[model samples]
Target: MADRSFLQWPFFEDRHRELAKTLDAWCADHLSVDHADIDAACRKLVSDLGAAGWLQPTAGEVLDVRTLCLIRETLARHDGLADFSFAMQGLGTGAISLFGTPAQQDEWLPLTRAGKAISAFALTEPQSGSDVANSTMTATLDGDDYVLNGEKTWISNGGIADVYTLFARTGEGPGAKGLSAFVVPASLPGFEVVERLQVIAPHPLATLRFNDVRVPKSALLGAPGQGFKVAMATLDVFRTTVAAAALGFARRALDEALARVNERQVQGAPLFELQMVQGHIADMAMDVDAAALLVYRAAWTKDSGAARVSREAAMAKLYSTDQAQQVIDKAVQLHGGDGVKHGQKVEELYRDIRALRIYEGASDVQRVVIARQTMGAFLGGN
Candidate 1:
């Protein structure tokens, strides 16, 4: 009903089409969750996703960006928390799946892939969010262990995760070069959930504190100084998936608008018959399709063996998220009073879409990335 035609695009293969169809059907039947208990809802969603083998891609030796995009798009369209649960599983353990040692992978991947454990990527701090180089969390090496001391805020699954792929300053050099990545279990001594953050849309988010928490050398994700690379690489894989999620939200908004305009009467005639209303639907449709194109293009580029899809991913994330916010706004306007009223689908989407533009990389940050990359290529430096 939402539109399966995108599956036939050249960016996707037969396998991707099948995945899209299968997941869409699965989401329709299984994505329903109680919003009153956010933690329980997220945990159950992750478990259900794992039981159905949907989280298997998160544990793969090589991340399939296309698969990640397709799943995120479909899940977001159905349920926001479902998308959050699935995306965090991939994002939290992404560093491990991409860089963890054999023993590390052996210990974590099975549980993560099976949905028996929740994972978090602890990178954002009170002083740093997009500015990874400004991170102040320290991981001091002490004999066979690294002692973590600092705090991370706005962390997805912060209070609920079983394991964390945490980035901290290890003094290898300066800025990003001095940082290191580690796999930390939530049960470590002195680690605490300082506070749970409630946002416009409900999901399990919190501020975490690490006070002299110790992890063995075996927890190091890669070489000590390669944490920046690890974080970037992981984000490179997941950023386009962010765009896919935005695309999903846009599509759902359009769908709700279509159904509303067709059924609602304005004066005596159907709202859909109005020329101005038709213009809004037209713009929403165009934005959805355009965002889908950009999302899939970035995903396909990454999956096709580009070492990194930074510029492409940034563009995809930028255009898709900004466009989606606009698209959802249009959907809300077309619904008149019902759009802003609580419990309406479009109203929920209005809340759901605001974060995509701000997270992973903000729209302004994306513009900087795109411009720098374009100039680098033109100047023969990239």
Candidate 2:
């Protein structure tokens, strides 16, 4: 109903089309969980998604970017929190999926994939949200263990996560070079959720503290000085999915707008009868299609064996997120005062879309990445 035509694009295979159809049906039935208890809702969503086998693609050694994008887009269309839960599962354990030792992967991927355990990615510090080089969290090597002492804020699934992929300074050098990644369990003696952060959309976010929490050397994800590489590699795989999620929100917003325009009467006719309203609808549809193209282009480029689609992914995320904000704004304006009211789909979407533009590299950050990549590409005579 919401344009399955995109699935037929050359970017996707038959299996991907089947996946979209099957998951859309499942979401319509199962994703309507009560959000009165937000954390509980997210937990149940994860369990349901995992039990349904929708989470299988997340833990595979060789990830398919197209499949990840497709799943996120579908889940986000139905419910944003469902998207959040699934994305966190992949993101929190991404380093393990990509670079963990066989034993490390064996121990955690099963539980996370099965939804028996939740995971968090601990990268951002209070003082270093966008500046990874400024991270001050220390993980000192002491014999067979690394003593972790630091804080991570704005962590998704913070209080509820059973495990965390933590990044800390290990003194290999300075700034980003010295950072190392580790697999940290929440059950460690010094790991604590210092404060639960309440954001506009109300997901389970918190600030985590580690006071001399010592983990075995085996907890390291990659080489001692490879945390920055591990984190960047993981992000390269997941960033495009963020754009897909934004596309989903925009698609839903378009659907809501269309329904409202056709049914809501004004001045003795349907609201869409006005030429001005028709212009808004046209702009919204064009934005949706444009965003979809960029989103899938990045996914396709990655799946086609590009080593790193950082430039493509950044472009997709930047364009799709910014356009989605504009598209959703048109939907909100078309709905009149009803759009601003609590519990409205448009209102919820307004909040949900805002964070996408800010997180996983902000819109401004993406621009910088794109510009630098473009400049380097040109200078290389390619």
Candidate 3:
């Protein structure tokens, strides 16, 4: 069983514990594959996860950050594809959960929870990664519809998703005030997957183009000029979960390394018997524990009625993701040349963890967020 010690932290409740236990069992039963076909693997995982009722936590009435974190961490420990399938469901429907009308929720949430519809979030553009307010995609209102025109690149589940939570510039005002969020169905005319992106991990990432795509005004997520807020709010909830996913990867790497060192022999003794190897293991354990603290702390703070968790989430995402990269790298190093061998679990983990640091919010952007929040708390009327 996955460790339940972290769930004992004051950050969690019985529901969180229940979620962890349920998801742990589900993952053990479902995630028994090294499927090389990324898209097919993700599809099967999503359907299985949804049919197993593990996805209800993502689509729950209350936005339980703790449940989300626990589920992602557990799924990630078992299968990154499983984690991605669950996360994109939440992210793709987060606006609907937070701000969608009952009509919208009834329309999408059930489908998402049932795994009949795959979701994607389209925010990053070719020129706009961390700087979301600088997005150039236009969604001009035309009578009862909004005609979308522009591109969104690096979209998770882009080609495979049945729908997307899209952000576009709907006004001429400067900065984020002019942007709006929309729930654009993939079946709409003029909405097309421009190109499929091949990444190190090989998921269904793509560049999307909306060439005069017209969506009903009802597709608007919140309100016009609130896209930035909605997006940030959604990220605030999801970012810590990203850290949780990283934590899972780190834990798996540690497990892999531990098994290797305990059995792999070297210089008249097992690797674990060597002082240097022992030190490496110690560091790995320390990093994993530290990451768990930050991750759970962020989730707890958010679930405790904090309006926003920018600082805490940034700290968690930044530290956990970066530390996971380090932990996985160390694991690779510990495995000697076998670590670098293609198709090795450690090698795949090394590649998987690298993108976590760069996406959601890059580590550099997270640092800026942390420093600014620190300064604001210290300087704003204090």
- What Cα-based lDDT does every candidate model obtain? 0.94, 0.93, 0.90
Residue by residue across 1-382, what tens digits does model 3's lDDT show?
3456877888888878887887787777868755688888888888888888877867655798988998899888988888889999999898789978788899999999988899999999999899998999999999999999999999999999998999999994788999999988999889888899998877889999999999999999887899999999999999999999999999999999999998898887899999998999999999999999999999999989999999999999999999999999999999999999997999989988888999899999999999999999999967
Q: Any idea what lDDT model 2 has? A: 0.93
What are the models' TM-scores?
Answer: 0.99, 0.99, 0.97
Error of 1 at 369 (Å): 0.3
Q: For candidate 1, write residues 63-163 as lDDT tens digits.
A: 99999999999999999889999999999999999999999999999999999999999999888889999999999999999999999999999999999
Extract clashing residue pairs from model 2: none
Per-residue alpha-carbon lDDT of candidate 2 for residues 1-382, written as tens digits (9 for 90 to 100): 6988888889999999999999999999888789889889989988888898888888868888899999999998999999999999999988999999999999999999988889989999999997887899999999999999999999999999999999999989888899999999999999988999999998999999999999999999999988899988998989999999999999999999999999999988999999999999999999989999999999999889999999999999999999999999999999999999999999999999999998889999999999999999999996
**Could you tell me the lDDT of residue 297 within candidate 3?**
94
Error of 3 at 68 (Å): 0.4
Per-residue lDDT of 349 in model 1: 92
- Which ten contiguous residues of candidate 3 have the minimum total lDDT? 1-10
